[model samples]
Target: MEREQLIVKVCGMRDAANIESVAKLGVDMIGLIFCRTSPRYVSMVDSLAGFMPNYTVNQLKEMKNPSKSTDIKVAPKRVGVFIDEMPQTIITHVYNYRLDYVQLHGYENRIMIENLRRTIEPDIRRNVKFIKTLHVSTLEDVEEYKDYEGAVDMFLFDTSCRLGGGSGQKFNWDLLKQYSGETPFLLSGGIGPEDVDNIKNFNHPRFIGVDLNSRFEIKPALKNIDLLQEFIQSLRK
Candidate 1:
């Protein structure tokens, strides 16, 4: 299926103001790192729910608390970026935060993603989406994951490294030609302010978006809003 518009996701958002700033730019999604090891981890916050925008009361009534209220000015979809987290722990965040998407960046297989998603509460799970990350170093790295085609809502292709992604390095973009599956993918890694023209020129039927992280950051978890605004404006046009 062809997407109406390409997705522009700005990941690793932690600060309350920074998150609001990026959301105001009208990006499609905002990602928060749940992996503790990453310097951009959002777990340090006093309350994750309070730090993020509130989910509609209609979705999960019990998860809503006045103390958890935030003033994010835009409605970008919220995504919890996880690295091999337990099923129960992930389930709790989905309930507590009402995340719209769960992005998995690990060695998890299709079965793991499927089963973990099934373990979520039915009402909340129905509103959630899953994005599986593929650290691409070689063509086979993507070609071999054909089974994930239907299991995930989307796929993220990033430079292969020990940390999974956020290496601020680009892999051989041509390696994507090997993938001919139905699942759409987001191109990430080393996407900086200068890549707007290149990202626009690149084309593939399944390419649906771009994921920005390290290159757009002022620090690990803080994004440069001015740079982001300029880049997003250019990419969208």
Candidate 2:
């Protein structure tokens, strides 16, 4: 986390205004959960008066490189977080939401990831990047990173627990030291405002960022912007 400009991905985002506010915070990415079982699910939202229905790629682009925003120059990159879903299902979401990244957060295989990647529209292919999640608890799980080496654009190492999707728990970070893979990754699971000191001290060659969720939320998908502002400012300091 001490590395200069380490990316910050604020995940499980739901509210429209809240998403915009967080984008103004200069976060690198904002993730919307697509898993039906997830409380932060986007389907119930986007079909109605939520983000996907109103927010479009042009609007997203404007948010990113806005000419008049004092808060941040670029908006947070949009990401669609999915479980083990069909390639066509993923394709529809990617096209509908205009996501910048797709976080595969289930027991997805390399073929599944590659197929989805290859199936995306040729024009949209360049704009989308895939992030595969590696739920870690022990050395055995960490070593599985190699199996996904050539499939994804990046890896997200989250905590392994029975209660999935925003399990507010942390795995032993020391386990990541054993990950000898080359793909850069975002450290997830149980990260909070309190981790600034620990995150600043933690260093890795391929470690690129952090994924904030349950720990920073006021409820299922509502984030405490004040707390996040303090955390980001303090961490960057």
Candidate 3:
């Protein structure tokens, strides 16, 4: 089969302009950081507030207490990035944010993935997609997640960091060629403007898309829109 359409995901976005820029690229999705420890954490309730015009911020605000309501309307698919959070906290955010997907970026296991899938699927009206992120330091590390094959919706293979993904570090791309399994995955690592041609040459049926972060930045939480647009447009055949 031909490679799956590369999902150009612009993660860790904070402001409306960055969100708009990423959306304008027609990227598959944009991420909002909630982990308070991340510098990219979108702390400005005011900035998130600005999205009210294009989206339903009031609905997001209501998600403050899940005992009330858990529905919100937003565009480009709202993804919440979490790292080793308590299950209740994840559930509460899932309900409050009305998130479409929850990304497990920390040291979570098969049980955690299975338990998360069970906890939310029954309570929510719609199916919640789960993305299990793996931070690879070596090929051996990449081989470990074969057990979760059927449990997640997608696999996000990112470069390992002292903190994790937003660390903007990169690893060996050739190592991905060794990934032998049926699961589809995303390519993320010190990928930047220089790697587009190499990406086009990457021939894997499961190569879904590229996740762009630090390398495409003008600053933390801000993406260089023009550069992103140019890069995305180049992907067209």
Predict model 3's lDDT versus the native: 0.77
Clash list (residue pairs), candidate 1: none
How does model 1 fare in lDDT?
Answer: 0.82
Q: State which candidate, 1 or 3, has the greater TM-score.
A: 1
Deviation from native of the Cα of residue 115 in model 2, angstroms: 1.4
TM-score of predicted structure 3: 0.85
- Model 2 lDDT tens row, 77-135: 88999888888888888887777899999999998788777778475556588899989
lDDT, candidate 1, 1-237, per-residue tens: 433567999998888777777887888898988888998887735363567644344224434654554443347888999898887888888887668899988877888888877777375566588998888899888875686878899999989997777889999898888788888899998899999988887889989899999999888989999999999888887
Q: Give the TM-score of candidate 1.
A: 0.88
Stretches of candidate 2 above 4 Å error? 52-70, 121-125
Candidate 1: count the clashes. 0
Model 2 TM-score, 2 decimals = 0.90
- Candidate 3, residue 167: Cα displacement in angstroms equals 2.8
